[model samples]
Target: MDDARQPGRAYRGRRRAQAAHTRYAAVLTTAVVGAGIVALGVSTALPEPRNDLSLEASGNFDDVSVRGGTDRAGRSRTSNPMSNMPAPDVWILPMQRYTLTSFYGERWGRLHPGVDLGAPQGTPFTAVAAGKVILCGWNGGYGNNVMIDHGDGIVTVYGHASKLLCKEGQLVKAGDRIALTGNTGHSFGAHLHFEVREHDKPIEPLAFMRKHGVDIQKHTEAIYG
Candidate 1:
């Protein structure tokens, strides 16, 4: 009787253990599958990675603009549409002259550095372009002088003036009278000494005037003939 009861009790215990293991295995499998689903959902909800890094510098990576991009050589490019455009047109002859007294070059064993136009004393001399008067006073060798800044490193200097009509810092238009012709500074007679300078270096005033659309030769011929 004792042996028979022991066998029955062992069989019941083994069945109960099997059932408990099956329930635990089902719960573990369900938890693992739920965690995998949640991870997949989170990955899908995130934003996609971008391949074009053109606007990374500006922090506008998603904004694709038409102006900035690669050129034909695959180098980076930027837009500057007006860089090659022509400068503004404001040209005029500084004064009516009787004759060209001295040219802009070596003279008397020294550099003349300007053009001398012999005109009647007290004749008004005008500005070649619209600008502001940077200097107006009696300079040492230049005598009563006037200098105008016409922007873009261009400056026009008028020396040996008998009188200055415009004061320093005064804004004047093209062809405005700025001074009067005179024999004030190291001069032999009444005339106007005009100089066109680019970045403080003197350039030929006649050629510079002609290049800016002022016909200096035409003005000379018309005045002479």
Candidate 2:
């Protein structure tokens, strides 16, 4: 009986030691996991790495290329819009006597999408082509403005006017007087701010007019000279 009791006591002691070892191992694992979490937090709090490389060292980010002008394989691209317009054979001059004050393009970091023609106040300016008047009213910045849609995405804008003679939706001939020029809206002096848009994108008005057999420079020289 004494020998059996001794063996039982020894077994109980061994079980207690194993339980304590397991508890110690669990505590150590928890501590290591907490330390790893703290290390991850400290690393994440640091600032992001900076790249001090220039554009030349990296790549050209400001390169602007015309859309639809080229393809991925370095081939010329072409497009055919369903609303393409027939080229006009002739176009009436917008003003009888005026000077080319400003041109259309980048001027002082801003895109001047139209040409400015300086004419005397109350000078009647006619339509450059026959079209239906789309807009005629007191427009913001443009003041008394007029817009004529000549179909096929071809549109003309007459801005900075003192008086609008035609009404919206009115059909006008090429030489019809649409408005009287004046110092209105954002104008410095009396002038007719004209614009030609092809599918709503502004293009060089001089080139457009010249393509229609209307030499704007010659007209300017004829009047101002």
Candidate 2 — worst ten consecutive residues by lDDT sum? 38-47
**lDDT digits (tens) for residues 25-126 of candidate 2:** 533443344322110000001112123311111111111122111241132112212123232223556854679998887665556668888877888888
Q: Each prediction's Cα lDDT score?
A: 0.55, 0.56
Clashes of each: 0, 0
Model 2 compared with the native: what TM-score?
A: 0.58
* lDDT string, candidate 1, 1-225, tens digits: 011111222122112212323423533443344322110000001012232211111221111122122341132113222223322235556754446777887665555667887887887778876566756766545667787766566778787788889986566655567888877756778787888877655678888887765655456211111
Top TM-score model: 2
| Candidate 2 global CA lDDT score | 0.56
